[model samples]
Each structure stands twice: as structure tokens, then as C-alpha cells.
Target: MIGILYFSSTGNSLYIAKKLKENLGGKIFYLPKYSGNGSEFEKIILVTPIYSFGMPKHVYDFLPKLDKSKELIVVQNYGGMVAGADYLMREYCTKNNLNLKSIYVVQMPENFTLSFSVPKFYLKKVLKKADSKILAVVDAIKNEKYNLPKKRKTKEKTYLKNMSNWYKIGKEFKTNENCVKCGKCIGLCPVGNISIVDEKIVFGDKCVACLGCYHRCPNKAIVYKNKKKKNRYINPNINENEIGQDI
Candidate 1:
């Protein structure tokens, strides 16, 4: 049996995970909600997006719990930069005793649209190309392709440094009057960093920077620090409800 454990913010990584499960017979598990090591499955894949050159906080914590005996394949998708994610994964596997078989890095449309919004037409073009690459990655995994990640000192250090910003993500976000106080973000947050306090939405420090609350907002109420209202980006291939389900 094959299992795919995935972490997605706006659906870029979810898009890849769904495609991989379509090609490779597997059960798709949401990383934050999934607790088991996946000892039942023979093959396991970790699909996620790179945040500031590193894995999301939820994915980073979940990686160590995976069963080492099963074959582990890692797939990371990013908007534009690769940022030495391969090396970071290699180091993580060594430290945690995980048997990482293959590592794949893919490019997708930039969804970080806190300030600068991406045109939907251009995002569609990017997704079209991404769809082709994802299939190729699936074939490679099927063919038993093995890869060794190259280590980079400078890039890895930068990656680690940038991760600190995720801790401050809660502080950077501010809700406008547009918010209906729907408390939707409370459910959408994978790490439980959001809640309704005193009948007001409150953000905590546990944010993993997945941006689910921002992109999946029904009223486009969440805004990043000091940024003018910009359009939010969600994967064109996946529906907003599916991403909001916290699966």
C-alpha cells in the first residue's frame, strides 16, 4: 500500500499530492491531522511547499514521526526559488533515521500574494506547466529513481534564518472591517493559531505560515502588515472548500 502525507497552504502542494495519489495507488493524509507513522503503508510520500526555503512548521514536525522502514519519497513545490530544500531534507533524514528514497523539487505559481498579486491568467499558464512536471515526477518515483541532495552551507543557513519570520506571521496579519467574524480562520489554521477571543479574532504565535486563512477567506478580510488590499492566490486546480476542510 502507498500513503501520501501532505501539507498545503493554498493548494499548490495539495495539487501535487492529489496528482500523485491519482497516479500511484495511495491514501492521502493531511499532515497536521495525521498522527500515525504510516506503518501500514509500504510507500509514503511527503508533499509540501517550501516556506522561505524550508519545510512548513507542521511538515517539519511531522517528518520525524514517519516509519523508517517504509520507503519515503519527498516532493516539495515552490513558486520561483528552489532554495536548497533538497539539502535540508537530506540533513533531516540523516538526523532522524528516515529512509528517504527520492527527492523532487517542482515549480508552481507564487501564491505568497500578501502584497503583490499574481494575475490569474499567468497562474494558469504556470499551473499548466506544473501539471506536466508532476506527472514526470510520478513516473520517476515509479521507476525507482534515486537522488542524492547536495549540501550548501550558505543557503541552509539562510533557510534557517528565514524560518524565524514564520513565528512572527501572526503579528504581521491584521483583519479589516470586512471580516464578518465568521471564525472561519479558526478552523482553517492547521496549527490552531487562530481563535475568537472576546468576540474578536485573535492570532497566536504558533503560525506555520501556510496562509490558508488568508487565501481561503470568504470575504478577503485578512491582510498582511501595511499592505494595500491585494488579491489572494489559491491553486486553480483545487476548490476553496477542499483546502478549507482541514483534511
Candidate 2:
């Protein structure tokens, strides 16, 4: 049996994981809630979004705990560029003694509202390409074609140098009066860094800067420094409840 473990804040990775399960036949495990040691499956697959060209803090924390004896595959979902996430995953696997079988990068819509908004037409095009790529990924996995790409030295080094900026990302987020106090942001936060305090949303330092709260806000109330909410993005195929169940 195969076990697919995924960490998705805005549902892009979750959508891919669901499709992988449909084609590859596996049990889907949400990484935040899963604590098993990978003993349940002959193969383990990790699907996650690229954060600052590296894995999120929770994913980095969880990697060492996985049973390294099982065959492992990693799929990274990115918006603009993957940078060095592939190399970072390979290094993590090597350090943990995990048999890294293959790595795939899928480009999804850019949900980073702080930087820019994804055009609707462009988003639709990306979704189509992502779906097609997922099918090919499933085929490769089935065939056990373990072809991992060589790391790009320059890009990887650049990503490593910029990774430290991720810590300050949460400090820029702010909600405007448009906020309905619906609490969707509180629940959608993967790290539970958002909360409701006296009818106002509050942010904590634990944020992994996934931007799920900003992208999934129903009223588009959340914004970054000097940036107004123009467009909110969530995986078109997944509903709000599917992405924000923690409430």
C-alpha cells in the first residue's frame, strides 16, 4: 500500500494528492494530523507547497520523524519558481537516511498576494497544465522511474541565502474593515497562528508564511503592508470547507 502525506494550506497540494490517490491507489494523510512512522505503506509520498524556495517549517520538522526505511517520493507545488526546493528535499532525505526515489515540481497558481495577483486567464491555463503534469507524474511513479534532477548550484545557493527572510513574512499581514469577522482566516492558518481576540483577528509569530489566510479570505479582507486585496485565490476544485476545516 502507498501512503500519501501532504501539507497544503490553499489546497493546491491537497488537490494533487487527491488526484495521485485516485491514480496511484493510496491512503491520504494530512501532514498536520498524521503522526505515523511510515510503517503502514511500502512507499511514502510527500506533497507540499514550496515556501521561500524551501520546505515549510512543519514539513522540515516532520521529515526526520518519517520511517526512512520506506521508499520515498517528494512532489513540490510552486507558484512562480521552485528555486532550490528540490535540492533542499534531497538533502533532507539524505540526512534522514530516507531512500529518496523521485522528485517532481508542479507549478500552480501564484497565491502570494503580497507580491502579485494571478490573472484569471493565466490561472486557468496553469491549472490545465498542472493536471496534465500530474497524470505524467502518476505514470512515472507507477513505472518506478526514479529520475531525480541535479541541483542547480547558483539557484540553490541564492535560495539558501534568502530563506532567512521568511521569518519576517507574517509581520506584514493586516486585515482591513472589510473583514466580516467570519473567522475563516483563523481556521485556514496551517500553523494555527491566527486567532480571534475580542472580535478582531490576531496574528502570532508561529506563522509559516504560507499565505493561506490571505489567499483564502472569503471577503478578501486580509492584506499585506501597503497592498490592498485585489484577488483571492484557492484551488478552483476545492471548496472553502475542504481547505479550512480547523475552525
Candidate 3:
């Protein structure tokens, strides 16, 4: 059996995880503030985003809590035209004592709306193309019948330096008055780092910096620090049916 474990702030990773499930034949589990068991699978896929050159805090917390006996595959999505996330997975796999079977990295648009400012129409086009690539990888991984590029020698000091700086310059999510306080952010957070108190959203240190709260808000009530000038992405692939369901 296989288990699909993933954290998706804005559906790009989720879409990929769903497609992977179609190929791998597994039980699907989401990582948010609330989660469930994955004990039934012999194989598992860790799907998430490469936030600020590192793994999201939610994923790190959720992963350590998972049953590590299963063979692991990692898929990380990032903004297009950037680097891949294999090195991040290698470090995580090493720290967690899991044998990583394979690593797949993809570049999607940046999820933070106020950061990169990708146009909605253009983003939809990109998602359509990216979806095809994800499906191709699913086929390759399921067959266990392909060769991957040789692992490149990495600069550990550089990698750590980048990840450290990102964590240090952590993201802050602020909910605007427009927030209906519907508790969507609270439920969507894989690590239970957010809560709705007195009709407002509150955050805890457990935040993984996934930006799900910021982008997933229905009314665009959540904002990243100084993000007024940035562009946000709303998944064109999703609508009311799939919305508000943890990315």
C-alpha cells in the first residue's frame, strides 16, 4: 500500500499529489493543524513546497510525526524559473532516517500574491503546463523504470546559509477586517498553528510559513508583510467545490 502525505497551501502541490495517487494507488492524507494516521502504507510520498529555499516548518513537524518505515518519495514545487528542491529533501531524509526512493521537484508560480504578482490568466496557463509535467513524473515513478540525473555535488554551507536567512526573515500573516473569521486558515494550517479567537485569526510559532492562509483567504483578507504591492495566485483549476479544503 502507498500513502500520499502532503501540505499544499494553494493547490499546486495538492493537484500533483492527487495525480500521484492515481498512479501509486494509495490512501491520501493531508497535513494541516489536524491530521490522521498513515500506518497502512508501505510507500509514502512527501509533497510540499520549497518555501524560501527551505522546507516549510509544517512539513518538518508533520514528517517527524509520521511512520518512517515506508519508502519515501519527495516532491517539492516552487515558483517557475527557479531551482529544484532535491537537496532540501536529501537533508530532510538524512535527518529523519528515511530511505528516500526518489525525489521530484517542480516549479510552479509563487503562491504569495503580494510577492511576485503573477497575472491570473498567465498563472492559469502555467498551471496547465505544469500539470502535464507532474503527470509524466507520476508515470515514471510508478514504473520504477527510469534513470535520473546524477546528484550534483552541493555546497552545504551555501545551502544552509540560504535556508537560515529565510527562516530568520520569517513571513508574517495578517488578517484584515475583511476576514469573516470563518476559521478557514485555522483548519487549513497543517500544524494547527492558527486559531480563530474572538472573531479573528491568531497565529502561533508553529506556523510553517506555507502562506496557505494568505493566499487561500476567500476575501483576500490575509496579507503577507508589505505584500500590498505583490501579486497573488488563485488556482484556476479549483472552484467552490475544492475551495476551503486545505489548499
Candidate 4:
């Protein structure tokens, strides 16, 4: 059986995985909830969002535990650009003796509202592009297309340097008085880094910096260093419960 495993914060990766499941016969499994040794499937497709040109911390932690013997296809959904993330995943698989089959990158709407605003027109355009890209990827995977890592360019190198400070990102997230202590952030944090203390939301050091809580907040009350300038983005095709983190 084909197994599609994914780690998604705001549902881009999850949406892609669901589409793949519809085109190809497979069962979708959330990476954060997966605990098996990965022996349940004959083939595996791993999907995740690129965070600051790198893989999420939870994806990094979960990679070593995956079954290296199975045929593997890796897909990364990116908002802006995917720098060395593909190379990094390839290196990890090589070192772990995993049978990496193929890798593809899909461009999705940028949901990182801390830095800039994603206008509705631009978001719609990117989402349309993402759907087309996902179809191509599905076709390639169906045909068993194998690929090697591309030559790392100078731009990718620069992105890697810039994203190197990703660990310091979540520390700047702050909530305003508009917060009603709804506890959504506490539940939607993928790494369980958010909680309630003294009836207020608290962030812990274990944050993976996925931005799930900030984007998914009903009140749009969570801010990072400053207030948000754009509207919150959740995949228009996906429901809140479909992507909600059950922490």
C-alpha cells in the first residue's frame, strides 16, 4: 500500500497530500501523529512545508525514525522560495541509507504574515499555480520518475545563510489585549510549545516556528514583534478542523 505522510501547519502540504491520495491510492497520515516504524506501507510519499528555506524541526526529528528501506518520494510546499531544503532532505536520506526516489517543490501562498502582506489577488494566483504544479508532481510520482539533486546555485546559498537564524523567530511572537484566552493557540501548536498559564497563552522554547497558531487564530490577536498588516490565510479549500492541531 502507498502511504502518504505529511507535516502541515496551515494545510498547504495537507491539501497536496489529499490530492495525491485522490489521484493515487494511499492512506494519509499526519507525521506528528505517526508512531509506527514506517513498515506499514510498500511505498511512501513524504510531504512538508519549507520553513525559512529549511525543514521544520519536527520533520528533522521524525526523519531518522522513518523506515529507510522503503521507496520514498519527498515533496516540499513553499511560500516564497525553497533554497537548500531539497538538498538538505537529499543529504539526510543519503546518510540514513533511505531509498529516495523523487523530490518536488510546490509554490503555495505565503502565510508568514509577520514579514509582509499577501494580497487576495496574489494569493489566488499562487494557489492556482500550486494546483497545477501539484498535478505535475502527481503525474511524475505515478510514472515512478526518479530524480537527483540539482546543482546548488549562489542564490540558494544566500537563502541558506539568511534562514540560518530561523530558530530565533518564534521568540518574538506576542499577543495583544484583544486575546480572549480562547486556547486555540495552545491546541494548534504542532510541537505542543504553547499552553495556558494564569489564564493567558504562554509560548515555550520548543516552538518549531511553523506559524500555525498565528495564522489560525480566530481573533487575529497573535503578533510577531509587531501587528499584522494582512488578513489571515488558511487554504480556502481546506476546513479549519482538517488542519487544526489536536495538542
Candidate 5:
């Protein structure tokens, strides 16, 4: 049996997990909501999106709990450099003695609206290319290719510095008059970092910086440092409701 475990904020990693399941035939589990250690599954595929060029803190915490004997495959979805995380995961498996089989990094559409411009017009072209890469990746997984991680030259030190700043990012979140108290962001946060305090949304300090709340805000009310970017992005291949289902 195969189990696909994934952590995604804006649907990119979830989309990749679904594509793998379509060909590989496995049950899917959202990592945040999942309880067990996955002992029943013989093969396990872990999918996650890169944050600060590495794994999300929630995903990193969940890694040690997985069944060590199971053959492990890692699929990382990224919108930018993956070097820090590629080395991090490989090193983690080596140190922990997990049955690490393969690792793949797939480029995804950017969802971090507060920091970068995610142009809607370019999504189609980007998705097309990503789909092609996903197909190739699925084929490789099925063939037992066992493609491993390679050291790619990147600013890993910069990534670490950025990660340190991510902890304080939620402190910058504030809503504008456009907020309707709809509570959508309350459900979208994987870390439960957003809440309604006296009928108004308030951000907590546990933000993992996935940007799901920022991008999926219906009214464009949620912003970092009182600035909402003109464009927000959710994966074109998946809907916001589906992404929120994990919550």
C-alpha cells in the first residue's frame, strides 16, 4: 500500500500529490490533520511546498514522526531556489536513518503576494510547463529511477536568514476596512494563526508564512504591513475551497 502525505498552503504541493496519486494509486493524507505514523503503508511519498527556500516549519516538525521503515520519497514544490531544503531533507534522512529513496523538486506558481508580483496572465504558460514536468516526474517514480538530491549552488545562508525573519512576519498582518469578518482566513490558516478577536480578525505569532490567508482573502483585506498587492494567486489547477478543506 502507498500513502501520500502532503503539507500545502496555496495548493501547489497538493496539486503535485494528486498528480502522483493519479498514476501511482495511493491514499492521500493532509499532514496537519493526519494523526497516525503511517505504519500500514509500505511506500510513502511526502510532498510539501518550499518556504524560505526550505521546508515549512510544520512539515519539518512532522518528519520525525513518520514510520522509519517505510520507503520514503520526497517531492518538493517550489517557486524559487530549493537548495537549502534539498540539502536539509537529504541530511535529515541520513542522520535519522529513514529509508529515503528519492527526492524531486517541482517549480510552482508563486503565491506570496505580499513580497512578489504573481501575474495572472502568466499562469497558463507556467501551469503548462509544470504539468509537463509533473508527467515526467510521475513516470520516473513509477520506473523506480530513485533520482536523488544533488547539491545545487544557492544562497543557503540567505535562506536561513530569511527563515529567521519568517517567525516575525505575522506581526505585520493587519486588515483594512475591506474586511467583512467573513472568517474565511480563520479556516485557511494551516497553523491557526488568524482568529476573530471581538469580531475582528487578529493575527497570531505562529505564522509559517505560507501566504494562503493573504492570497485567498476574498476582499483583499488581509495584508502584510498594511499593503495588499494588486495581485493574489491560488493554483489555477485547484480551487480555494479544496485548499481550505484541510482546515
Candidate 6:
């Protein structure tokens, strides 16, 4: 059995993972609420986006708890240069004693800050290409048509500084009076970081900085820094239905 484990906030990585599952066969598992050891799959495909030049704390914390005997393929989707994380997958396997199979990088449009604007046609082309490349990799893994990499040392950083900063800056979630206090923001948080308190939306420290809360709110209640631009791309998965639904 193959275990496709992933962590996605804005649905880019999740979209890729779902596409990979469509191309290949694997049971999908999310990397949240980690309990006990992982599944007994002989092959594991780990996918996530980089957070501040490193793996997110949720992924890093859960990696140590998983059984490392599986063949591992690491996929990191990033916006800009993924500095200092080239050895992340191999290093993770080394620490946990898993066989490191290969690494693939897919350059998706930036969803975090949205500083760069990706033309719609170009974005579609790139995602289609990524789908094909990831499908080929999935085939190789299924057939064992690859060699495992050597275990190497990884640099140790607690990742607390960046995470703390993100939480500090990102905890500014607010709901407009238009908010019926429906609690959509609380539900949209994948990490369970938000809650409705005294009929008002409250954000907690458990935020993973995925920003799903800001997008999925029904009444458009949630607001982060630069709240004016909040509703710009609430749903980043710009497929046909979303465009129609928003219109």
C-alpha cells in the first residue's frame, strides 16, 4: 500500500495530491492530528509547501512519529527559491531511518503573499505540466524504477522564530458586523485555531498560517493584515465552478 501524506493550506498541494492519486493508486492521509505511528504502507509520498525556507512545524513534528522503513518521495511546492531546504527529505529519512527515494520540486504560483501575479492561461499550462510530471514520478515509484538516495545530516533549527512571527502577525482575524457569527472561520481553520467566543470570532495560536480561514468564511467575516485585499482570492483553486460561483 502507498501512503500519500500531505499538508496543504490554500489547496495547491492538496490539488496536486488528489491529481497524483487519480494518476496513481494510494490511500490519502492528511498530516494533522498525528497520533501513534503512521500506516504500514511500504511507499510514502510526502507533499507540502515550504514555510520560510523550511518545512512547516506541523510536518516536522509529525515526521519523527512516523515509521521510517517506508520508501519516501518528498514533493515541495514553493513560490520563490527554496533556500536551505534542498536536503530536507533525505535528512528527514535519515533521522527516522526511512529509505529516501527521490525529490521533485514543482513551482506553483505563490498563494501566501500573492506578490507575483500569474496569468490565468500561463497558470493553467504550468499546473497541467506539473500534473504530468508528478504522474510520471508516481509511475516510477509504483514500479520501483528508481534508486534510493544516501542519508545525509540536516541542519537543526527549532523553526520557532518564524512560526511565532507568523502566528503573531496572522492572529489578527476579525469578522465584520455582516458576520452572523456563523463560525465559518473557526471551521475553516485546519489546525483548529479559531473559535467563536461570546458571539465573536477568536483566533488561537495553533494557526499553521495556511490562511484558509480568511478565504472560506461565508459572510466574509475574517480579516487579516491588509484586510482590504482579503476577499481578492478567497478561494485560490480557480477552476471553472469557483469562477462561476463567485460571479
As a TM-score, model 1 comes out at 0.93
Candidate with best TM-score: 1
Tens digits of per-residue lDDT, candidate 2, 109-176, equal 87766767778999999999999999989999989877686865425455555555665677777789
Q: Estimate each model's TM-score.
A: 0.93, 0.91, 0.78, 0.90, 0.92, 0.79
Local distance difference test, candidate 3: 0.66
What's the number of clashes in each of the models?
0, 0, 11, 0, 0, 0
Q: After aligning candidate 5 to the native by TM-score, how far in Å is the CA of 124 from where it should be?
A: 2.2
lDDT of 4 by residue, 1-247 (tens): 8988888888898889889988997888888878885788999988888876667766777778888888889998888877777887787777788888888988998877677778899989999988889999989987877676775642444445645555466677778888999888888787788887888777777766788888888888888887656578888887778873321
Q: What RMSD does each model have against the real structure?
A: 1.7, 2.4, 3.6, 2.6, 2.1, 4.9
Using lDDT as the measure, the top candidate is: 1
lDDT of 5 at 18: 84
Kindly report which residue stretches of model 2 are placed more than 4 angstroms away from their true locations once superposed: 154-164, 244-247
Candidate 5 on 70-110: residue-level lDDT in tens? 89999988875565678777876766778899988888887
Relative to the true structure, how large is the alpha-carbon lDDT of every model?
A: 0.82, 0.81, 0.66, 0.80, 0.80, 0.64
Question: Candidate 5 — worst ten consecutive residues by lDDT sum?
Answer: 238-247
Q: Which stretches of candidate 5 lie over 4 Å from their true place?
A: 152-161, 244-247
TM-score leaderboard ranking: 1, 5, 2, 4, 6, 3
> Candidate 1 at residue 155, lDDT?
65
Cα error, residue 150 of model 1, in Å, equals 3.2
Better of 1 and 3 by lDDT: 1
lDDT of 3 by residue, 1-247 (tens): 7777777777777777777877777755666533654557787777887765566656756666666676778887887532434665576677777757777777776674556677777776777778888887888787874433355554555545655554322346777668888887777665577886776677766555566667767788877774664555655565523532433
